[model samples]
Target: MATCCFLSSSILRHPSHTTPLQGRLQTRRNFSFFKITAIFWGPKKTTTPTTRSMMDVSLGTFTLIGSPEQKPPVEPKELQQVSISVVSSISNVSSIDWDACAVDANGQGIFNPFLSHAFLSCLEESGCAVQETGWLPQHIIAQDENKNTIGVVPLYLKSHSYGEYVFDHSWADAYYRFGYQYYPKLQSCVPFTPVTGQRILVRDAWYKDQVIDMLISALKDLALKLQVSSLHVTFPTETECQRMKKDGFLQRTGMQYHWKNRNYKNFDDFLMDIKQSKRKNIRQERKKISAQNLTMKRLRGYEIKDKHWDSFYRFYRNTTDSKWGQRYLTRDFFHNMGSKMGDNVLLIVAEEDDKLIAGALNLIGGDTLFGRLWGCLPQAYYPSLHFEACYYQAIEAAIELNLSKVEAGAQGEHKVQRGYMPVATYSCHYIVDEQFRNIISDFLVHETKQMEVVMKMMQDSGPFKDGLE
Candidate 1:
């Protein structure tokens, strides 16, 4: 509800040798919805004191900073660019280039198991993400002068926002009251996935910004031509959000828990790092599983056999059926992803007397591990099995892989006592209805403020040792 702008007193000079666009003048933009800071780049460097500082710039329908006329210089090779279009299917994209672009940005083609071609292909092939199931693929691609593929975005036209983790149901209900349709909004993200990674895939890292800008421009243009409500990019990194903010996108925030290692040599070392009471509690839980004669095996990629996946699927079903009374994925989905992704997928299974009792599945990213799903058969050790299969095994595997952090699934305060620290996650929304946009924007302002306060509070309660030596 409140907005403020401050101008930079000085500006940095750029050298002429480098591309003028890189040196182009930048203007800072601050928004009232939340304290969002954005810097816009122009084609050439300028030193005007007014242009140097981040100031609020507003775009039509959406608000952002800087002149909309500012454009990056077009490359000569792309001058005769071929027309690219958005398709509602990933089956149309060239896999080699798609994987190449994905790897170029994130260092691996697919970070989240749910985003992998195998996983998506299974969803599409299995009719899980089809029109019948409410998930319709809306693939966005960019091409060069020769019509050769240059970039791609794995998108889906979602009917319901379930499995997104980024909640916006209230916004949908408000829109419904005003006779507006919220379903089928353009979404550039992995289906049924909350893990964050590159949503825009660029062939070359050098043209990263260019590729992203082009994607945004293309999506906006497509949204207009197709008469879609808006484009939603969820679970994007801070960098991607900043870029979108510059291009005039709304920002929303939420919190999730993740575990991080500080040179923990083993699980005991990690326990020692937590509060003494928590340490004892966790050890006791592990002892309970041990006393039930249950042991867990950590399997990676190809090591996960069909039988293992089958048992894991059973475990997954048990948990979902008991809790939600339904399951999201089928057994075939697990087999397909395991066969395609190999070692990137991890499965930890608990066995009693050589019989599998529980299992959990996780997806590994460049620096993060994500706990996707877990379940256990009706065993004597189901209580502690959830923690061992879902959290503890994940932490152990993260240490083994030397990953930076482990993101436990959504909305679990219990994870905090188990070494998972609370961190804020983000999602942005743009409502097409004029009145609704204003209403939701106002709501988001309050929500973001509350989330920020909660994040700060959680940080204060972090289990980490306080202080400087």
Candidate 2:
């Protein structure tokens, strides 16, 4: 019989010790499924080989509270009623409700329908994200009583972590030392995106925990059943981390810099927020570019035509060719994005002597704007052209659009001095091998603590008069 269970809190009066395998669940709403497996964490023994195979894919409930300034604690809880079903493809799910979970509180962030059926369909249709590309989409969606989506996680059964920003090369090396395989790991993340948003999209705070617990459990079980190396959830919220921690997932911390709008009224207000030295240097950079008879223009939505993509792709090709062995996005992909995503896209191009010298492409979200790709012609000698095309133009547009933040992409201490604040990102891990898991867990504890300390120190060293205050 298919059953549904409702849990309001974490007051676990009856939990199993050892490993929880198959358990009976009480439900309010009737849900249909081909198979049913539930695990509640407590102090009872219920471990079996078959049970282990199924239970490995389940997770219990937990919580994460507070902000970067103050660390909070998580109270332990058990999952009430969870239904786990595996689909053969992402096409089975609707992208509309699945993507709705990504809508931020602000109305100005990018609502990329890429995770949608049409987009994922395009990837599968275009052969962009497939076995050949090492990206196998294995999306997971959880629904409640009315069959409305409660949560959806865009997952990939990745053979390599090339596009993922979170580096696990060190962990892989350590595993190899002990004679283990780390390839063919399960990844729950947005493909080729390091921008911070809801990786696991759920409704309210209560349903959020429930849906997250469900995903964690399913991934673990899939790892064991498929005999894969590990399960990774990248760039999740700190609140998501608390639930993951309670479910026994290893946590890792990463850093990315984002510029926030501080009632900046305009561009000059933003420049004044940075340190004086940085402010002067930026002014000089802007001035130098202005002196070169270069004109910069921002084209959004339908304003960008097919010919624009041709020039932009050429610039993109030049940028990638300059790198020793950099991977390049196909020309078709860029054209497709601009075509499919209108108004949501922005192209900042620099023109000099009636020729396109540099360009940067950004995906504009509701409250946030993301800098994704950039390129420049070698002959264009506009000073600080890269910064202007990528950063300055983005800041100006974000302000003009009244966006709350502009994420400048990854890795830069330099970005800190440029008025971008440091923010900590998170990833959750589950290693199959016990020995390796323990070693990694120890590493995480130390790593997380160090990250906390560094975040505070960076806050203290922030340039703005009222920055950390």
Q: Residue by residue across 1-469, what tens digits does model 2's lDDT show?
A: 2222211111113234322212111211222212221222222222222211221132333233432333343323422344555543566666566556655311234464433444455555455666677777766666653566666677777777777788777666555444456677778776666766556656554445545666677667777776677888887778776578777788888777788887677888887777787788888888878798889999998998887888998888777778624552566777777776778889999888878878999888767788877888755556688878888888999999998888887665656666677787888888876656776776565555545655676677776766333
Evaluated at residue 400, the lDDT of candidate 1 is 83
lDDT of 2 at 1: 23
**Residue 390 of model 2, lDDT score:** 83
Per-residue lDDT over 310-364 for candidate 1, one digit per residue giving the tens place of the 0 to 100 score: 8888887787777767566777888888887788788888888899877888887
| Model 1, residue 140: C-alpha shift (Å) | 0.2
Candidate 2 regions exceeding 4 Å error are 1-83, 104-126, 143-149, 203-208, 378-381, 449-461, 466-469
Model 2 TM-score? 0.76
Residue 88, model 2: Cα distance from true site in angstroms:
5.1
The TM-score that candidate 1 achieves is 0.80
Tell me the alpha-carbon RMSD of every candidate.
Answer: 13.8, 15.0
lDDT accuracy of residue 96 in candidate 2: 68
Top-scoring candidate (TM-score): 1
